[model samples]
Target: MFKHLLPRMRERSAAANRPVSLSDMMEEFWREPFGNLSPLFRDAGYPAVDVSEADGVVTVKAELPGLDPKDVTISVENDALILRGEKRFEDEQKKDDYHRIERAYGSFSRVVPLPGKVKEAEAKARFEKGVLTVTLPRDAAEAVRNIPIEGA
Candidate 1:
């Protein structure tokens, strides 16, 4: 019954640079019943992120729909900015039955590499609407350092 999905599983595994077992493929296949309806419905990767730097500030924006600000955790560690969060799905089905759940839910973590050193203590984050924006001011000293030239 699921023989047709093997090729797709292999492609997905190869994209991630890892091997996918039959059980793992089955689990993912069952997780989304209407996954092939459209690209929007497919779990192509959650919380799509964009990182940009300008005017001595590094900004990271992530799309996190249906998630509260409290559900997210932002931190800078090891020269990278880490974002961790979860999207919980609550179905209060009293009479209507769910035909499809296109929204991918569960916990997710995204690590963005910093363009330069940032002042961790001065970082600021704000969650407005479904977008999460994190602003990190670059460390003036570390961002640009000059070394004296010694002639041999």
Candidate 2:
């Protein structure tokens, strides 16, 4: 039935290099077979993100071409860092229409969980040259705690 057909369909899709249908995209979002695949497909045009941790700071940088800083939003809830933004496509109406449209538009979000608790007040973010940089300072006490060993 569908179980056998799914693999063949996937292989056909790969061979054709066609974009997955919107319904299939929704299904993948719900199943989350590969974890965070939604964002990857939703914002396929955007460059990959870079995350780094050093000492007590965590840095995340993402490339968002043609996106304005005002359209981007960054927030922290609990131990998760959330980045949300929109990429608007310019409207063009001409006698000669476009044959193909590939760039993605609309809202995108990326939620990254911190390795340890962070100082929300100290978190800083900057955007320049179509790149967004978010810096989160790790809470010192939460970063590491000495556990006293006792003889049993």
Candidate 3:
């Protein structure tokens, strides 16, 4: 029944030096159906992100554990902040037997819409302790204006 996913599951089993069981294949079949439905879902595979604006500056933070700063790329395009990174699979040369592997290893991209106009040229990013913080100074000249309503 899980023929389509057998090869992929076999590779994972081989990587862990374990045999793939029928139950394991069934579990993977159920889990793969919800892939990338929405960023609102916690299992969407995208890193956790927080965005806030204060004092004409917009700050964005993303959690990226087990990733080097160089592996991540940040950019601003179409008034959105784009975060891209890859977490490579670690291959160990030890003789220890594996039990469970839950960490995700692959490339992920996240697009966050900016709250307002920002100076993309002056944007700054810093990575500290597996967290990436990006600061973007908002453009005051292009700030939104509230027009008074004359009549309905």
| Top TM-score hit | 3
Write candidate 2's Cα lDDT for 21-98 as tens digits.
554556666776556557767555344578789988999888888888899888999798888888887776656578
Give the per-residue lDDT of model 1 (tens digit) for 26-143. Answer: 6666986665478855644556888898999999999988899999999999889998988887876778788887878888988888987899999999999989999999999886
Better of 1 and 2 by lDDT: 1
* lDDT value for model 3: 0.86
On a 0 to 100 scale, what is the lDDT of residue 133 in model 1? 95
Per-prediction TM-score, please? 0.65, 0.64, 0.68
Residue-pair clashes, model 3: 0
Better of 2 and 3 by TM-score: 3
**Model 1: which ten-residue window has the lowest total lDDT?**
36-45
lDDT of 1: 0.84
Clashes of each: 0, 0, 0
Deviation of model 3 at 35, angstroms: 13
